[model samples]
Target: MTIRYPNGQKFTPVPLRDKREQPRDHVTFSNRGMTLEEDINATNAYYLNCGMAVIHKKPVPVQIVRVDYPARSAAVIKEAYFRQASTTDYNGVYKGKYIDFEAKETKIASSFPLKNFHDHQINHMKQVESHGGIAFVIIRFSQTDELYFLPFQALYTFWCRMMNGGRKSITKDELTACSIFLPLGLSPRIPYLDAVESMYF
Candidate 1:
């Protein structure tokens, strides 16, 4: 017998025994084909554990509307959506100062597109800067695996130019000159806080 979903698609049913024997490391998808965001998040975890500068990914809250109670053991999400882009990507206190930043990645080698940074992201960063906090974006060129710590002020500069009919995308050369290059490391992977320390502290 085959179980068909509401969409008229056949649902493959796993044997109960096989389901029980399923691997515990399903979350290890990152280990297999991880992203720059995942690497940076792992690095943040390391920093938190070591009592270093505290930083964390800001969760986008969602209103859960439906869930499937497959069994007493599991509650599966059926539908959900983000409430809004409320704030920056990450925020925390670092050495008596507040820190806030967004992380982004792009494959285009010549330039980082302005579309990557939304107006809300820029507005939130501006608020952080106004309050005397550190605001920046950690951008990664996925093709090269190179990362940079771009300050919010510098971004705002380019943002102004673009708003006034200038180049829409920032060239890689401009990024290299305006931002601090983050050192890649084996232990922490991104080693972003190192760049932060060198800049502020």
Candidate 2:
């Protein structure tokens, strides 16, 4: 099967992991090993435990068509399909303010590809912004081990330019000028809310 963007641009689903290989031990603690989803999940748990906020990853509902019961063991999923396009990776309340955002990671050292985002995601952010909620993206540059908090307004500006035949990636300088770098830590490894407080609040 093939997937295409709304603009008819061919979209190739990047290889996430080779099914025939097992991840090696002693792998560095980087975005290559841990995805944004995993980091946010752990952070959300920390937030809840510390009474900081209530946030959750929205599960993508799916229909399971086939399952293989191999020997008397666990069942393996054979076929499944997403029910619909996901709105956002996460949403919650922080300091009595509603928050909605998406998280993305890039291996590129210089820029984040615009292709990493979709039109639906822009629309979702617009909706959040319209509701007077905080909307933004947490972008991680794996090569540099740097994470930045980019507000939705900045993202929307870049997105608009992309639609007008601008560069497909946001340059490092642009990110530096428009985003707030989040400090790494032990608990809530990516302390983005700190940046939020300093910049937005």
| Candidate 1 global TM-score | 0.77
C-alpha lDDT of residue 136 in model 2: 92
Whole-model Cα lDDT of every candidate shown, in order: 0.80, 0.82
Cα distance off (Å), candidate 2, residue 123: 0.3
Estimate the TM-score for candidate 2.
0.76
lDDT of 2: 0.82
Give a tens-digit lDDT track for model 2, residues 1-201.
Answer: 468889989877877666337444322322344566687788889998999989888876688999999998999999999665457778999999998988888767888877777698889899889989999999888788798999999999999999999987799999989999887787997787887788668
Q: Write the per-residue lDDT of candidate 1 for residues 118-196, one digit (tens) a residue.
A: 6888998999899899998888877788889998898999998999999988899999999999878876888877877
Stretches off by above 4 angstroms in model 1 are: 1-34, 67-76
Clashes of each: 0, 0
TM-score of each: 0.77, 0.76
